[model samples]
Structure formats: C-alpha cells, structure tokens
Target: ALALYVNHRVRVPGTADIVYWLADEWDGKGIFLQDADALVYPYENLKKVCEHINEKLPFVERIAVYATAADVLRRTPEELAELKRLKLGIIYMGLESGDNEVLKRVRKGITAEEMIRAGKMMKNAGIRSSVMVILGLGGSELSERHARETIRVLNEMDPDYVGALTLLFTEGTPIADDYKNGRFHPISEFESLKELLSMVEGSDFTDCFFSSMHASNYLPLRGRLPAEKERMIRQLKTVIEKADQTLLRPESYRRL
Candidate 1:
C-alpha cells in the first residue's frame, strides 16, 4: 500500500512549499503604473522575500508562484536556473487562449509564441511548468480556431500539467459587458464539448497530465496525454452521441 502522510510534523521531507505573496497581478501588457494594484511587491523585494523564506524553511522540497506568461518570459535563463537551485520546482501560468486574436480580445498582451518560449525556458531549467487554457474563450464564432490553436500550442510546449477551464465572466468584467451588449456569443454546452473533443484529438504531447476537470467545465476529463488520449476522446464521444444531459454535469453544478 502507498504510504500517506497527514497532519504530521516535517520529520522527513515534505512537498508543501511556501507560496510567497509577491504580486497581486501580472503586468502582461507592460502598461501598469508603479502605483497600480496589479503588482504587489517589486522584483527586488520579491527576491528578498523568497530568500528569507528559503533561509527559514530549508527542508521544503518546492516553492511555487503564479505568474503570467509575459512575467514568466521576462525571467532570464540565469534567473530560472537560480530559481531551480532554490527548490522552486514549479511556476503556474495562465495561457488562457493560444489564438492571438482571442488573446487580444481578452487583453492578455502576450502572444502564443511568448508562452511557448517561456515554457521551453522553464523546462530546460528543470522547473515543472503548470499552465492553463480557457475553453470557449473565443466565443462561438472563433471556437474552432481557439481549439486548434490551443492544441497546437500545448503540443509545442508540452508542459508538465495542462488545465482546461471553460470561460465564465464575472460581473463588470469586459467580457461580461460585451455579452450584455451582444458583442459576444457564449458557446452552448454541446458546442463546448465539440471544441474540447477537437482539442483532445488534435493534441500531440510527449508526456503531460491534461485535465478539463475544473469546476467551470461542463464535463470532467483527466488522463495522461497520448497514452490516455484515445480513452478521453472516447468518453467525450459517448456523451456527444447520447446527447444526454444526465451524462453531463448540470448547469447548476457549474462554478467558476
């Protein structure tokens, strides 16, 4: 049986790492003011904070932080290598969408090329990269393009983990406002499944744990890519063929 560790003191090694609260938001556009709410501590201050944590918690096996693709790409190879040496094994990033047009629509600033570049750098530095892509991000009109481009990008990056989340707008967000003004068209559940299916079919990964199991997704699927790709696709196809709501997560169960 597999050994389980819970509620125990760190007698041996532990996986929990201190997530240093560096910044509230990433300046993907490179236009935020110094006093803006987007960034929390400046880079120098963040480094000092990380150093302090490392000094205090020398036994921790990993340290992680969330960053935008632009922010991550801004890190030089030396910085990534240094971070790896510091036991910072992972950097979580939001790719959102790989289609440049969709990225522009969302004001995400960084292009798909930038994300790929950053992923390669992180991989080379021995950092486990966890990245997310938003489904239905391009609305109904560009759904296919979004899926195709996202699959292409993921295949290129081949990050350690891939998270797929369906798009949902919070109140007052630009996308929500666009929906109110009839400028955006949300994809139906069935249509979203088609997009997901297309993405899974098109993807070609060496080894990555891919999942659309986020709460926002209409259906949950998780498996290793290429190895379990066919099984995942078959699961989705079963639901599509049945056209059964009972087989799918209900709308009331969906959450952001």
Candidate 2:
C-alpha cells in the first residue's frame, strides 16, 4: 500500500494541494533505493485512492511518479493507459548510462535493450518518458563510448524529454570507493563537454527536448534535438574553443 500525505500549497487560484507518497516497494536501479522491492499497487486500490483524492482535492494538475525502465517494461499496456487516464503526465527514469559496460559496472540490473523497449511501450500507451543520463558515468576510460552509446540508445528510445547530468560522487558509494582506489577516473571539464557534444551531435531524435541544465553540469544547455542540434553544438564548441574555466560551472558549486 502507498501512503499519501497532503501538503497545502497554492500554485493556482483554488487550493493547489500537492499529494505526496512513497511507493510500498520500488524497483532498485542504482544506489538510490538500491534494495527497494519491486512492488506495485493493486489497480482497484490505486483507483480508489485517486477517487478519494478527487473528492478531497480537485485542483491538482499533476501527479508525479518515479520508476525504473524495468518497472515501465513490467507494466501492461492497459496499466499504462490507466495511469495516463489518472493524469500522470511524465514518468521519471534515471538512465545513468546507455553503455552496457558502464551499466554492468554500476549494477543497474537492466539492459539498454530493456530501456529501449520500455520507452517504446510508454509511447505506445500514450505516456511520456523523461529520461536522464549521467555525463561522466563511463568515466575517463569510456567517455567517448558512453556518449556514442547514449546517443544510440536515445535514438532508439526517442524519449519525449532527455536530461543530461554530470556524475556527482558521495563518499561511501561503491563508485566513490572505486575512484578512491584508482579503479575509476573521473572525466575533466573539457572531456565532459566533449562527451556532451558528441552525444548531442550523434543523436537523431524525432522531436524531443534535450537539456543539460542540471546543477552538476559544467555547461547548461537546452534545446529541441535535431532542430537545435547545430545551435547547441556551436555553443559547446565556442566554450570548448575558449577553454575558459570561467565559462564552466565551478566544481565547488556543482551538486547532485
């Protein structure tokens, strides 16, 4: 069962209350919720909760939900349709990297193939996917491979929205330990920009919005893919040519 908590906040004229909840169990993808169980609410129970919400607060415009690609893949077309019917706009997917080697090293527990299938499933069911990829996830060793592979995956998935965030390490995580032991080498600012440039330049999307405006990113960029591809690449190229540290976000200011 999912627990709901109501926060009285106004974003519109009427009461713009936001209902928040944690899933009874969630599919583990990475360090975040790594051990979470893959449990889903019963349809009847889910519907009843929505009915209760509708009765109590009728002004809510969106209900946000987080799920892994595997979770989305597990959903039947009917279930996905029902979720759309319930007004769930976009499902947040943290696709850390599209490189299979990086994925295995990180223990993501799902494959690029699964992500592609899941993304298509959402589109077929009239649901939108907002997928995110980590910029330095493949580290220095596989930076180029990461970017190219990510482009490959995104081209196939063709997500409605794509987010690019640079990797941020916490002290105790496995990846952090790897870094400490010299097993993993973090990419430099220029290298990260190179990867980002390659990703945007290589990707071929059918009308999708791409952004690297996350705080962790050294350079922030947002534009429509393919259409604004040249513009974005030019901007990256300018910064790359300048090689100005002032043009990039400082390491001290970067965060998760």
Candidate 3:
C-alpha cells in the first residue's frame, strides 16, 4: 500500500535481502511480494531477488506479486521467461475498468487492448495472470459501458483468474473528493451487484476462475468460468431480486 502522505512510488532498499531474511525465518513454500507493483523493480534486480531466494531457499516453490499492465509491458520476453524459470509463478494485476473514458478518468495509463496484451504476455511466458476489475468504477454514468467493455476485454485476455472488486472511496483520494463535491456518483450496493452480474453473464473464458469474492464487494462469488457460469449468474439474480440487505455484505464489513 502507498503511504498516505507520499504520492510518488517508493522502492524499499534491499528488498531482496528482506525477502531472503523472511524466507529464512518463515521457511515457507511460497513468497509473495506484497508491494504495489513488484515488477516495477529493475529487471536485473528482480532476477537477482529470485536467484537469491532460490539459492538460499530451494524449498520455496513459487513467488508471486501484484503488478500493473505497464509493469508487464516494460519487461522483455526474455526477462519474463527467465523469471518464470526462477519460479516467479503468478502476478495479480488490476484492470480496474475497461471503458476507455472511465480508464482515462482514473488515469490507469493503459488502454484495454494494452491491458489484454500485457495479460497475454504473462500467460505466454508461463506466468499465471490473475486480473482484477473494479465494479462500479464508472459510477452510475458509465456502468453498462464499463461492464460490457470489461467483459469484452476479459474474453480477449482469457486470463487464468479474474477477481472483481467493488469501488471504494478513500477519504483522501480524488474520487472521494469528486463524490463529496457531487462531481461523481457512486452506484448503490445492488447496482454494483448488477454490474458484477453482467460481467459473470457476459464473460466467455476457457477454464478461467472468475470471482467477486474480494472484501470490497457486497456479494461474494467464486466459480470456474463457463463451467459454473450459469450457477453463478442465477445466484446473483436471486440476490438482486430479493434485494435484502441481510443477504449482502454489510457496509461495516466492506473495506479497501
């Protein structure tokens, strides 16, 4: 997570040393770098981190981290392959929203096509790609467009996993400021569920696991795409039709 007071990206010094120390202490099979964008580290440094971990802790089977579309694109094919060889197994990337205008508004810095390319790149390099899209990101204005385009992009990417998160306005963020000024409107909890429903219904994936099981979401859903798609869709429709607050996650429980 970014520090509340500092806006710019901050790279912790000796990240590899830290990971090595943690792995040595914990002796776990996996190491997940929970930084905002682990791939943002320079390629040589990233490789060294992996190499150091493998050399020091051969029992560690895999390494994972959060990444961005830009981060994936910045690495060369050779570098990605090398990382995969070093057991850099999976990456979680936030697609946020697929509507171009909505993406521009949020300053995601990459088009939907670019995001798809990045995902495909990771998959081609034998790295599992888990893509996340934010529900209600377009607010009430572009909700439908956001869902439709996001489904389209997900279909194109055919990622190994898809995680759906609902939009939450932090107090100090620009979106929250817009909400306070009435410049932006957030969709209701039920509306967010509807958006998630559209994504589950419209998505066409080959053996992909799709879910809205994040803490930020009102409804929690998880299933293999295409196979359990109908079951998941029916579940969402049932919840929406009932519209019972008791049936959904309470606001107090939701968080970023």
Provide C-alpha RMSD values for all models, in order: 8.8, 7.3, 7.2
What TM-score quantifies how close candidate 2 is to the native fold? 0.82
The local distance difference test score of each candidate is 0.78, 0.79, 0.88
Write candidate 3's Cα lDDT for 32-69 as tens digits: 87667999999999899899878766777899999999
Q: What is the TM-score of candidate 3?
A: 0.88
lDDT of 2 by residue, 111-224 (tens): 998989988998887777889999999998998898989889989999889999999999999999999999999999988999999998898999899999999999999999
Q: How much is 95 displaced in model 3, in angstroms? A: 0.4
After superposing candidate 1, which stretches have Cα over 4 Å from the reference?
1-44
Task: Evaluate candidate 3 by giving its C-alpha RMSD to the native, one decimal.
Answer: 7.2
The collision pairs in model 3 are: none
List model 1 lDDT by residue over 167-216, tens digit each: 88889999999999999999988888998899889988888899989999
Residues forming the 10-long window of minimal summed lDDT in candidate 1: 1-10
Candidate 2: the clashing residue pairs are none
Query: Which is superior by lDDT, 1 or 3?
Result: 3
